[model samples]
Target: MKPSKHTKNQENSRRNFIKHAAVAAAGFMIVPRHVLGGKGYLAPSDRLQVAGIGVGGKGQSDIASFAKTGKADIAFLCDVDDRRAANSIRNFPRAKYYKDYREMLDKEHRHIDAVSVSTPDHNHAVQTMAAMQLGKHVYVQKPLTHDIYEARKLTEAAQRYKVVTQMGNQGASGDGVRQLQEWLDDGQIGKVETVYCWTDRPLWPQGISWPEPAAQIPKELDWNLWLGTARDLRYVEKLVPFNWRGWWEFGTGALGDMGCHLVEPPFRILDLQYPKDVQCSVGSVYVDEFKRGYFPESCPPSSHVVMTYAKTKKTKGDLTLHWMDGGIKPERPAELEANERFGDNGVLFIGTRGKMICDVYGSNPRLLPTSRTAQARTKKTIERVPGGAEGHYGQWVEGCLAGYGKMKMSSPFEIAGPLTETLLIANLAIRGFDIREARADGKGYSYPGRDLKMIWDSQNIRVTNFEAANQYIKREYRQGWTLGV
Candidate 1:
């Protein structure tokens, strides 16, 4: 006899809870309730007050999207760098401006309803955590946290506080990703064993070298505040404002930057919970006058990281997901036909029955034989992935206002949290030590194998080889600027 819906739901919930518990214990820990409050909601009748931190690049784009909708008031604008924050300031003249986000939150907590964090990876957790603690909803840029530990905390905060949360992986809301899920559910790629995701990132915003020593710090910028929770380091122009993506301290290199967009479809379609093991074969690290004490290791700066996920009864046994970053990609699989080689960066799903391939936007996705038989089988089920409408930022605004909306948010902490954890670990792997090692805090992980293969205690979010990698997790916070829930 079939189980009742309630029983089935209970069983599913129990299993999912166990899975999350196992992952949390071994990976990272999050306490959202400590940060986000569950006392209120922004009703549809309410006009949402929004703040923005780090107002350049993607942040500017996010601001425009928010402006498109009438539901939100851009009330606060903050950024460590004055120049970068200028445009956004002008964009919202009615909004108050500040250089430090913490000050903005502390002073304006009573009035603000939500915040958008589009800063460097290192600053995301602190600012977002601060806002959530005051019961503010948050929309953070992709790859949510700089370290695995922050991801868990932010996830918990979002859940515990009941604040509306979204990650800026815009592609998450794309109709294409949803269709990718439908395809997987319908068994288009039978008995999936492997997934290959790649990207053309590090193209513009990537490949920057390490910083040198402290030079004359810019007057317009608050160098100390910029460092925030990171270790104290000399300021370098190349490492600031924009070029931080290539640095070890500020960015997660290529993987952390692009994995959320490139890898989301597979993770969603395959229903990825957590990988049993993660290993990386990174490229050479390079040097720049900008990269002296700032980054310790050099040579093989880029990498090809391979993450392995063991199966639950739901998955097809062990699955290997390979990720390439910083312009390095794996060679085309030998099994493909002559013309079937992949493009510069895309996804390839190899299952027992056949294969499926697509790009980040999920266009030109075609199955093998690339013709009628595949089309006949897939057409009835094939649906166009929604193009970005309402956009990610717009969607967040709607959600924040409690507008009756069903727009899918790509970077909801539920998805962004794990995605961030997986990508952040790649950085942990390359650093050869967890960022928190300098501290005796029970946070961070270690890779026992030289190849950077690690077995994580997901419940505690600790690495089995903590002795080696723990050093990279938490860094020395600048005085008066530490981040805590």
Candidate 2:
């Protein structure tokens, strides 16, 4: 049957929309509009206006969480890849879209009250500093910055700009952390002296050479723009849409990935700050029969970094923190039954009297010995965040509307900044493990710097004993990519 031209065009439009929607949903979640908002719901002007940069994967979920708060207007979405950004575009159809965040900020900064940054570790500092410079509230994902310098600067900028800042480690606002603090306050775990945090991460590749032959860049992704603060390079397969965590340029490895979530409880309860000294051992990857690959461009497959912190008001003396990543775990405590779980990702606190443990995101906190978790319940001295973990988004939303420092936050920069530095310091120790230099005789490489404990002068921001380790404290940006702090 011959159809009218209008009908044929309408059919084409429907098919095109469906095809485009499906592609966006290919690697991302395509949430229904009803899930984001219902009818008769006009987002209020008083509601905080948020523009998301790098809106995909965790970024996508982050903006959605903010929207679900009913107090945030997701007014703008930005991403380097259209395919990765498709779902967010669909969820926030009314919001404007852009490929570069700088352009969005240039044009829509006036409209945006706050910005949420969920980009890679490398871009975090530049994007965050830019937003702060614009006097916009910011909700940045955890391990605040790729370098120690950036973390310190962002922490300072938040104060100077008088803008509310929240790190995306929502556990900072969770009941788990509050509960840990309460347990500490009640003296259940008296004067914690030793701590252990572990995670099974790098579910991505690490300790490998850069791909020799570059793969064709995806049509959906702007490879150059995606490189943001990283060095110029040909598009490599599997580096995008995820797996960048294994690379030193775009990601901070497992410690940066999970440390913020697992380490915050101990940091909060024990009032821990920058470590005084750090040392680490990393698992070596063997390329063949007799050769071990020390791919300078990649992080280790596994690492065990140990950091020593000076006594704080909450501690008895010098406390030791152990961070295990890349599937390495600490020896199981005798208190836990072999049959029971110690959690795939968790933190353990050892004190004068007892021990406590918690899972990732600081959830399911408990005193060791399954029975003690219930038996030794402390009074709820610390107030709980309403709605618990999910409240993190709302807490930031309310705080943004209330002005900087008006309302308490779960992971404010003041708190998160120092916490992030803690992990980066641990990372410095990890990076130090593989440091190499040509032998004085010029025969071969001599890893003289290896196995040395880095002495950190937090005030000066340098590794006093090992000059080579200080490089990680503040990485030089690639050409044309300034941190802008």
Highest TM-score model number: 2
Clashes of each: 57, 0
In order of appearance, the predictions have TM-scores of 0.79, 0.90
The pairs that clash in candidate 2 are none
Give a tens-digit lDDT track for model 2, residues 1-485.
Answer: 89999999999999999999899887468554444567644446567899999899999999999999877899999999999899999999999999999899999998999999999899999999999999999999987999999999999999999999899998888888888888888998888889999999879999999987889998889888889888887788899977898899888999999999898888888888899998888888988898888897898999999899999877779999999988899989999997989878999999998998999888998887879888985788888888888899999999998998799998999999999998998888888777888888999798755678789999998899988888888877778888675
lDDT by residue (tens digit), candidate 1, 106-190: 8889888889999888888988988888888899988798888889899898888778899888777766666556566677667
Model 2 lDDT vs. the true structure? 0.89
User: Alpha-carbon error at 462 in model 1, in Å?
Assistant: 1.6
**Regions of candidate 1 where Cα sits further than 4 Å from its true position:** 1-45, 204-209, 285-300, 312-314, 333-341, 361-364, 372-390, 403-408, 433-449
**Candidate 1 local Cα displacement, residue 73, angstroms:** 2.1
Cα-based lDDT for every prediction: 0.71, 0.89
Residue 161 of model 1, lDDT score: 77
